[model samples]
Target: MTLHQQTTRRQFLQGTAAATAGLLVPFASRSFAFQSPNERPVFATIGLRNQGWGITNKSFKFADFAAFADVDANVLGENLEKAAQRQGKKPDGYKDYRKILDRDDIDAVMIATPDHWHTKIAVEAMLAGKDVYCEKPLTLTIDEGKLIEETVDKTGRVFQVGTMQRTESGQRFLQAVALIKNGRIGKVKKVTCGINGMQASPVIPEVKTPEGLDYDFWLGPAPKVAYRALPEMREGYGGGVPLYSNCHYSFRNWHEYSGGKLTDWGAHHVDIACWAIGASDTGPSRVTPLDYTLPVEYKEGYPVVDDQYNAATQFNIQVDMPNDIEMIITSEGDNGILFEGTEGRFFVNRGKITGKPVEDLESNPLPGGAIEEVYGGPVSENHTANFIDAMNSRKQPISDVWSHNRMLEICHLSNIAMRLGRAVNWDPAKREIVGDSQANTFLSREYRKGFEIDM
Candidate 1:
């Protein structure tokens, strides 16, 4: 079937399923025939970088790539060829992501752009009638999270945040939450999340923008600034680019584009911590920056120096969670979460879960379908599979925006507390800072001219 015909067929099937069952059926249990290319959902990916390519690469089995968009032409071309080889069909490419949203044939979009660009693209995509699967730390500021949440509710779209631990990580996190709920760790008291720290960089000089890269578009919604980089190349998983540049993988080290490790790793571990403790629906009462070391000086919350990484290099914060539970977020010790309660405690990360309680699980064992109960259904093949399932059911996926934003508020407040060198009070009900007006100003940002969200 042609692309248009295939889209129509899928819509008819979806509507039929909803009508027959009085609700959309989950993708796994539904007896829909989707073995052919024409039956797969049409998808496009924006921001062809480390995570942009990662999510799209995993989604190939469930969706057909109709297009790809990126501000850097070189990166776009390279990923297009890679995608074609993998799927045996070349997709159209564009530097502007809006062109992809303009296509009616596209059913959904996977946004893995920089933290600064996430909110704009995601909100616009949903407005254009497309489901979204955006990477975590979903918003640059707390206000942006509210904007995306409002848009999702307004558009009735299937939105999924890319916190794959909810679906992947070998279901270890699921088991961890299940254990907590089953009283394996009775009356949880304190939870520590050691997300680790990033290295401080030497002063990076301003350099000419690289060829085939649109520097202005890359800085969308962020303050306009000179492109900066050093000649030294990073030598690991996210290498080839300058190790100290304020772009690419190094963007995580700057406050303009990302929230450093606080929002980076914190998005993952803190999210799981809140879920296990039954605080996913609520917010913290206070966030105090006990100790932290910023790479550069800061007069207010804004950084003083423009060259070096400004985000906290090493830090520790104390968060007052609901029920008087104390949560410690620090960049020390092993990179994982340690959950301590009245009865027992355990440590969990992407690799393993260890503790006396975990050891006893082999003999005592969780009740049948315990993990599924936490997950709300049978686990899918991967995170992307869960997104596709949500698309079919028209239901929110495992990592919904509400829970993600609630946990992310802790991380955002931590950075704010560290920047101001004081504790900040948070009224979860109002979703705003209590008394500190200056600190509350950091909750939202002014967008660069011409790049503001149309909403």
Candidate 2:
């Protein structure tokens, strides 16, 4: 396969300027090459809620919106109009995402569905001969990650998880990785990832499904349950729906659909931590839940209550990573990562990268192309740009499935350990729980009838 030429440092800086100006320089333009509008890839987005619309919105620069799909008609229609306004043309809309997959015109599908729906849609999209760019926390379980990885290998499709920190976020994360690899931090000893906790909701009541929203379809592979909500609308970020409900933005709080903060913010911070420490392709040997608090009671690793949030409320997990590294994932402290090494320590997050090593950059800076070297080549203008470039080159993007799943396994194990109230030993090579048949059952969930993946 022929690879696209890596972007030069000057070109990357220029592309960054274009991104800041709200105009993405086309991938071809970065190489002093031009692509006509018709040459852009065709894309259709599934699950057009908060993050569904977000990834699609950024992708408008590299791909044309051919259609949009969502279980909520209101969300579908809203994003359709938004896409038309931004792209100067209205794409089609559908309640069934499968309809988008059936279309031959769409070269790729951007999946921003809830965690439960990610594997099904992504696997089907790949089998249907379409590339995929799915959101982070890519799987709800370890088994789902394995299935997705297998499907990607079988189809040879380009799959990019929406972990934008690897490409964007002011390149602070990239700089952090480069600093670590350059011996600025010496041999890494301990890394703490501070992914904040979720608030336990006061008993949400089972309520009538809203108009134009297909509640059943939203539930999908998860167990059938009454739509629960309180008559209060959430305000910012992923607002508009009931803030305490088991649907929409609050879906992350339910174990049936997502894995709370362990997978929510853990997907971002843990992914970066693993990459910086050269542990992306491996896994932790033991996941010990030093301390944790689940919002509801559980029996046999299953939540007892159905009306309230069931995922972990706060947690402090210690994972024994490769190379005798100590990794502490906790809900306490500021929301960021702290890398402590033999020589020095540094803290980094989306907002800033600080400490002695970062301060030393003024006198002794990272070598030219350091960030690109850490990124495996020139970084694209944005994550979506990297996806598009991969589509053209037939290469996997920065946040590939193999690495994403490896790091995500730690988050998944942390949740499992907390749910079972015991540390779970893992065999990374076998990808299974050791000596705990009962605990191993959580690796894969049984899908609800008629919603199972039809591989």
Reference-based lDDT, each prediction: 0.87, 0.87
* Model 1 deviation from the true structure expressed as Cα RMSD, one decimal place: 5.4
Mind giving the per-residue lDDT tens digits that candidate 2 earns over 328-384?
999999999999999999999988788989888877887766766787776677788
For model 2, state the Cα shift of residue 335 in Å. Answer: 0.3
The sequence of per-residue lDDT tens digits that candidate 1 reaches over residues 117-217 is 99999999999888899998899999999999999999898899999888777667887888899999899999999999988999999999989999999
Candidate 2, superposed: residue stretches over 4 Å from native: 1-33
Q: Which residue pairs does candidate 2 place in steric collision?
A: none
